[model samples]
Target chain A: MLRNISVEINGKRILDNVSFEPNRGINVILGPNGSGKTTLLRVIIGMVKKTEGKVSLKGKISYVPAEFFSAQMKVSDVMLAGSRIELNEYTKVMKKMEIQGLINRDFSTLSSGEKRLVLIVKSLVEGDVVLMDEPLGNLDLANRAKVLRILKEYDKTFIITSHEIEVLDFASKVLLLKNGKVLYSGNPADVNESLLSELYNVKLRRGKDGWSNFRFDF
Target chain B: MKGINLIFLSLLIISFFLSLVYGQVYVPFDKIFSLHGVYKTVILDIKFPTTLSTLLIGICLSISGAIMQLLLRNPLMDPYISGTASGGAFGAVLAYYLLAFNLPFSWIIYISPVIAFMFSLIATGLTVLIGRKTGVYGIIVGGVVISYIFSSLITVMITEMSIRFPQVPPLIFWLLGSIQIVGYTDVVILSLLALGLVLVSLRYSRKIDLVSISDEMAYSKRIDPNKFRVFWIALVSVIVGYVVSQVGIIGFIGIIVPHILRRFYGGNTKSLILGSITLGSTILLFSNLIADGSLGFEIPITAITSLIASPIIIYVLVRRNAQEY
Candidate 1:
């Protein structure tokens, strides 16, 4: 939960008096590029200093950063670098993800989606409240589905940020952001076509099936 | 314990023995035990201490390199690159003039290592201070500039010293670096200091591993990377200072030993540091052997290290290029 959070970098306000409370389940922050989604996540994790705000977080917080690159290390070593869990527990979690084979592979050898998934797995095993920034970014359709399934099954608080509108389907609560300010925060089911069209600055039509579509044919 | 470490250990041992025997006058291993003359004195008193000094210096430098690399998060970092070696060299040369001129500060000037350590620490402090806001790449560039500044100062002082005392022969050879210990006392002091520092570094190996990757990652994990980096910078400065005070600035061993060992260790700071210890000593011992044996006369140890390590470093850079997209 944040109370009037304001973040400024180099005299430019990146987050302007933002305030929102995440739900107990998966709470997703939906925004387009340059909408300060990553900054808000970083501020929560204490990676970025907030100029003025109060951040109240319960329990241990683990984070999956949007961009990560490591030394030429084994995947197991990368996962266990500063992990809070034991090896057996970590192994069990990896088994649940069905990515046990990835443990022996070099971290740099993995594809982008696999790397993100591995980091997600690392955070899942580590934190009570996991904060992920653009977790589904750069992922293909199949890999995106794989991650969505894992997040759905995991019984924990996840504060996830995404530019893609598809993430709203599984999100219990949604915070709509535009130009570094919160536009709306409530149940995702309450969100409508006009609000998203304003948020993305593109005409989005809510079809009869309750899925949104861009006005353009593409 | 492992294959690579065991191989390096064996090589270190063999080179140790070989360095003892293959000096100016070849004293065979068996002959030294029974001979009770100049040969015995040469092996026991002169060659033995010098060999130990080289080994200790090697340990100091390679460990310094490993620490710098981890602290800066750059694999190419070394004491030489961070201005520590040139700073120590400048301090060592400054001591000569301080004594010759009979300066007011008597205590520190009397001991070269004390003054050398002081200057090296100051150099590192200045480098970090200047580069504080600029990040890692800035610190590296600052170090290079500082190194050149010290090198120029050393040249100016040496020239002034020569002009003042016409009888004094040029100490140009010292700039090239050599294992020139005063006696066994130098070896003993260096051994205790190097061993203690290396042991202390081993205790922080886990912390080093955590902080070496990225500052944000370390901060997220609740490790203070800045504190660790400062501790390591001071540690490397002291190690480099003392080593250079004993043996004039030897290069390449610090950079080469850790780079070669990293292929096997792969981001394991403990294993990389431990391997650097043995591998550094082995490579330096062999360099010392070539310095004393192959040329039929004593040559600067740096000459051989540069010759051998340049190709290895070039190969590493080329391989890195090949692998990158």
Candidate 2:
């Protein structure tokens, strides 16, 4: 939980007076680049200490950052680096993510998408409230679907940041952030076109893509 | 691999045996056991002390290197690379010039080690300060720059000392590097500390693995990277300081030994530490063997190791395309 949390770095406000109480489901923080989506997630996990506000976490926080790279290590060791997780359950998680085959492979040897999946798998089972930053950026069509499946089936709370509007379909609660401020923080179904246009500085309307239509205003 | 351990131990034992009898005169292998003749005099008096000291120095340097790799989260971190040894060397030489150079050299021995230890501690402080700013790649640059400065200072002092007494050539051994010891006490004390520190280091193997992956990962596990770093940094300082003061600065063992071992063994911190102690001791012992093998003309152990390691490092870089760092 946070109340008026603000983060100012070198006189530039990265997060300005942001307040929110995240619920136990998919809470997506949506914004374009440089809008402080990453910073907000970092601030929640104590990675970026806030300059002003009262912030207190009620549960343990784990992170799966957008960037994925590690020093020389096997995939299994990478997952178990922080502390030992229950092996039986961890193996199940890896299998579900379709990464059980790469268990003993070197982490540095993995492709970007593979690295992202491994990081997500590690984060998914690590903490009470996992915070993911751009968790689906490098994933392919199949892997992205695999991620959505996992998120939908997961019983724990996850706060994720994504620029992909398609993610809103699965996001129960969406926070529209713009210019370091929260433009809208409520159910994703209630998000309006005017609010999105104002947030992204572009007009948004219903557009068709293949079999499905999405909010697309190019 | 259990086989690797057997190989290292076998090599260590062979090196010890060879070191015991390969000095000025070959004391026959059979003469090693009977403590009664010239064999006893040579073996018990000189060879035994020097060989044991070399092994101890090897363990300390190797383990220090391994911990440094984890602490700095950079494969390049080592006592020599980060200038901790250089700082200690400068301190030792400076103390010798000021406190004991005029007196019989034995008189200054007491003060040099203490001052060297203190200076090495300061070097670690500087390394940590610079490392935090530079990240992984820049930390090596920072350490190398700092050490170069210290090395120049030592050179100037050495040149001045040569002008005064004309007998400072021996001191150059410290600059280039050596496991050459002046006394047995330094080795004994260093070995004890090394043993304790190695055990303590093994305890943090899990946390170190996390810390090495990413600071954020470590934070998630409730382990503060900075706190773990501070503790290990202090450990490396004390270990490096004591070793440098005792045996001068033996470079590359910490960087090269663990890296080579990591290829054969895994990259986990526990395996790295264990492999380092075993292989580290064996490599130094073998180097010392080669150095001592030249009949009637002994060479500095530092020169031998550099000659051996420089080629291996170059080979690694060329083969791996410089990805290990």
DockQ of each: 0.40, 0.56
**TM-scores for candidates 1 onward, in order:** 0.88, 0.91
* Model 1 regions lying over 4 Å from their true place: A83-85, A206-218, B32-35, B104-115, B118-143, B165-174
Tens digits of lDDT, candidate 1, A1-218: 88899999999999999998887778999888999998998788677899999999887788887876555566777777665467667778788777888887867567877878878888888888888888889888887877888888887889999876777778889999898999999999989888998888887876565553334323
Q: Candidate 2 residues B1-325, lDDT tens each? A: 6786798889888888887777555777888888776767677666777778888778888888887887677777788888888888888788767633357766556767677767776777787789878776678788988888888888888877776766544565777655544446766786788788788988878788878777766766677788888777777777777666666777888877887887787677887888877788888888877766545676766777777778766774464454543
For candidate 1, the iRMS in Å is 2.4
**Cα deviation in Å at residue B263, candidate 1?**
2.4
Local lDDT at B96 for model 1: 72
Each prediction's RMSD over C-alphas, in Å, is 3.3, 3.0
Query: In terms of DockQ, which candidate is strongest?
Result: 2
- TM-score leader: 2
Which runs of model 2 end up more than 4 angstroms from their true locations?
A206-216, B100-111, B124-137, B163-169, B293-296, B315-325
Candidate 1 CAPRI-style tier: acceptable
Reported per model, the fraction of native interface contacts reproduced equals 0.25, 0.51
